[model samples]
Target: MVNRVATYPYTTSMIAENMRLQVKYSEINTQISSGLKSQNYKGISSDTQYLLSVESAVDRLEAYNTNTNIVLANVNTMYEALGQIEDMANSMLTAVTAALGGGQVPTAVTANQASNALDETQSVLNMKIGNRYVFAGTNIDTPPVDLTDPAWVPQTSPSVVNSSYYQGNSTITSVQSSESHVINYGVLASDPAFEQLFRAYNLVLNNSGSITELTEASGLIRSAIDGIANVRSNLSINAKSMEDQIYQNEQDKVYLKELTSNIKETDIPSASVQITEIQTQMEAAYSSSVRILNLNLHDYL
Candidate 1:
């Protein structure tokens, strides 16, 4: 009897090769459709640790950007409030100085002006940003200044002058601008300038038509105006600092995003070329597999 070699090995090898080609075709299709080499970390296991680290860094940068935006908004609001207060204080000073220079007594118009200024100043001090008072320091829930009660004295006496009008503490508010940097940007309602302004306006509005009282009030208003000017200067410094921090944070975010994209984003052109090559290979493989499956020894003879 002649020994015959088994043909099973050849058939099994062809089938296995065809299966592998099918799997490769499927993978290429997925890459083309999704525009990504790997959908999950496991797909790119070799670079998984590096990719995760880049992603984490990007997330941290994004978080810093978000915090910087919030801080900028809050700072802008505070700057506006401070600016308005400064303008109002200057106007009050102008009015008081004019009246005192003209030797005029406390007129109704002047008193009304003083009262309006006081009301506006108090309102500004009590201003809120989304239910949180900006001037309230760490005590953000409550208004920084409260003069709504009848018993709240608005006077120039030693007791009233020395009294604390701020409902919040002296704690300054701060924000993290970077991993190693923080910015303190807090102003209190009970600042000495604001107190003097309130006292001057109250005294002038409640005066009994005395020129001496008006003159004294004028002097106090001038002092308050000067004090407010100093406060504005300080605020400008803080605003500049905030602007610088925002710029730096934005630049860092841009760099981090680019770095992350380099690590994870797919090269579309390169992937498209690979898809074409794989498609051709798959077609050739399928034709070869068909020929092999249809092979017959009689046809060969």
Candidate 2:
């Protein structure tokens, strides 16, 4: 009986080099299959660190884009409410003109009409979208105005009777849009528009039927009504502007998503073909490695 041992024809260094290349390819393929390139700097080699950073940044940018989309949606909701408010103000203006002419006496203004307008105004004031008030300032959960109280005056705090309470704050807040700019259009409850109109609402409903009351009160009411209209016009413009911006942002997001998808999302068909080819190559390499490691000079005999 004869015993034979295999002699590896390949040098130790060559075998080590081939194993290293295969290991590197395996790592890259793993990343491709999992759709992530995040690096463990503490664990991985320095060569792969750069790829990890790039993936992390892509994830961050996408997160920022998602947040921007949310802001845009909130701004869109606010714009809708603002437009509705403008319509409400216009309707009030028409009522004011009728009241001014005495064509419609304040006495004839049904409790329904009075209450309805007040309720509608309150609805406007307490409007909520995305859990935030369209009109209420920073403290949104608390509604801006409370017209439910029969004694509740429209604008003036405590009582419409108070002269000093006529003025309220007039600061605006903004919502971010994805279009790289902001939509500045948050009118607070303390805005002059509502405060003055509230006064005029009280006077319109309360004034007794006197020629002098009609003369003086009607003038002030009409002026305030016009002011409401002006604010509504401004809001209309803002709404249109925001709509335009939303459209533009949508286009921008489409492009960005494409870019990110190219980097992150997989092409299943291409990847499947690649996997098959890699499997075939791996089989060939294994066979070749086995052949090179098993040489016998006794074969010549």
Candidate 3:
């Protein structure tokens, strides 16, 4: 005859407990391996709102940082272009000064040099970073200066009556550096200094064969050199401001990342200890369940 010991209920309870312990152990192991408390928002039930807020803040800050980097790159490009232009202006001034001091007439060689300098200045003014012209002010899609077109005339005379060769508007370009800060780091090709340089070069290229014209051009070149020097100084100041803003943004990002990590990242040491404990419990439950199931009247006898 079979022994009627009510063992079925105990076996069923042990099986349920074993399944629970095994699931918990697997979850802990996964968390320890992945080093994240939760893979998704649904799994992060505790402090879910706070975690979400921090994540959103981090995302915004990352976006701002990306924008700042792009703007900084553009600013650097502008600075380089300006430096090149300044160097070109200084060379032109020196050549013209030497010619005036020697009382030499401007020759074909001088005209060629002036032409090359003018072309290079125009090219730099129309320089593009990506698809946008860095010196175009608000008209980023348009070239700032167009010296190649024969139909184009100088709109501004020596007295600054109207616009110049630059086709762009007067509006300055600004970029968002941070939540509270915006930077106006843009320079226009139509700036008075650039206008003076372009005009002086044009005059030299056109009438370099005459002594009187060459002397007049030399004076203008000297004035342009001084003007360009002042603009370069201002640009240097703006570049430094951009650098400081970038540094501050990086610092803020570090703090924000740390905050997000504290909210979302798993504690590896604690998770490891919990996983070991759960694994031990599961092993014990399995052993106990197997022994209980194997027991029968024969063992008792």
Candidate 4:
């Protein structure tokens, strides 16, 4: 039996060209299967570029969120401190308005109550949330008034018994909002409100409960207390606004994540189908290559 010879010429150029075409098709199929245009660093360009960038920006966005949260939390500390100040102010005013008599009350004026009030004022200055100073102006790490740090206050007395001495700088500092705007954060101890209240402390302490001094300073301190309350209200409003923004940002972040996933993330089902198609084509090319390479001079004999 004679075997029929088929005409076949497998030149280097033809073989090389066929190999290139097969490899190209295989790559496209592999890409579809892997759900990626580029598996290694070399094949890295595609629509996913933007998705990768957005994912990277999440780190920065999250950092901004952290700062915004800190500001909101610090506002809480300020409110609590203001409440303490208000309580002291109200108590002092009560003592002043109440008519003191020999039988009912001690005639000798005691500066002790005023002293405690001054102590409360110090607390307002030294307000801290966690380990950070909430009212330290720009000095976040260092206490605004270092009572024990030995830098600002060398053996500084926690109790400012002498209200005549102003506790802190009157300058006010603000905090950044979650929206990148500045908002009034908290009041400084040297604020006008505190100054007026301090006067009352001085009057009561210096006069030693003289009804005349108590009455005069009472009005000033009461007004100051009211002012502080106003400031506290403002801060609360600002904090609530920031909180709302943060919540909104969180939603936005979720949406962005979804967008990135859709753009960049690979689908397993689609990838599997692509891989199977590429394998079929590759096998066909391999068979053709074997048939051509098998042809020899003996076929013409």
- Candidate number of the best TM-score: 1
Candidate 4, residues 86-186, lDDT tens digits: the string is: 88888877766652333344434346777677677766677667776666555556545433322222111122333234334444666554445566665
Task: Please list all clashing residue pairs in model 2, or write none if there are none.
Answer: none
Candidate 3 wrongly placed segments (more than 4 Å):
1-26, 107-113, 148-162, 202-216, 275-301
Write the number of the candidate with greater lDDT, choosing between 1 and 2: 1
User: Taking the tens digit of each residue's C-alpha lDDT, what string does model 3 give over 1-301?
Assistant: 2324576666678789998988888777778788887788778887788877777776777787788788877777787788899899889887776666664644677888888998899998888898998888889899989875564453222323223477888888887777788878789888877877777777677766656766767776777778877877777777777778878877877887887787678889888888888888988888887777677777778
lDDT of each: 0.75, 0.56, 0.77, 0.65
Best by lDDT: 3
Off by over 4 Å in 4: 1-42, 46-53, 99-103, 107-110, 128-133, 139-171, 177-179, 290-301
Better of 1 and 4 by lDDT: 1
Tens-place lDDT digits, model 2, residues 45-164: 543455455555545545555655565566556556656655655665566556556556555572234455556666766777777665665665666776544555433222243223
TM-score for each candidate, following the candidate numbering: 0.77, 0.58, 0.74, 0.71
The ten-residue window of minimal lDDT in model 3 covers 154-163
Candidate 1 per-residue lDDT, tens place, 1-301, comes to 1113686777677678778877776776777677676788787888888877777766776777677778778777877887888788788878777677675644787888898998899899899987889888889998888765455575643325632567888898887777787878788887888888887887778762556766777777777778877876776777688678778877877887776666556677877787678778778878887776677667758
Per-model root-mean-square deviation over C-alphas:
4.1, 6.5, 4.5, 6.5
Name the weakest run of 10 consecutive residues (lDDT summed) in model 2.
157-166
Write out the backbone clash pairs for model 1.
none
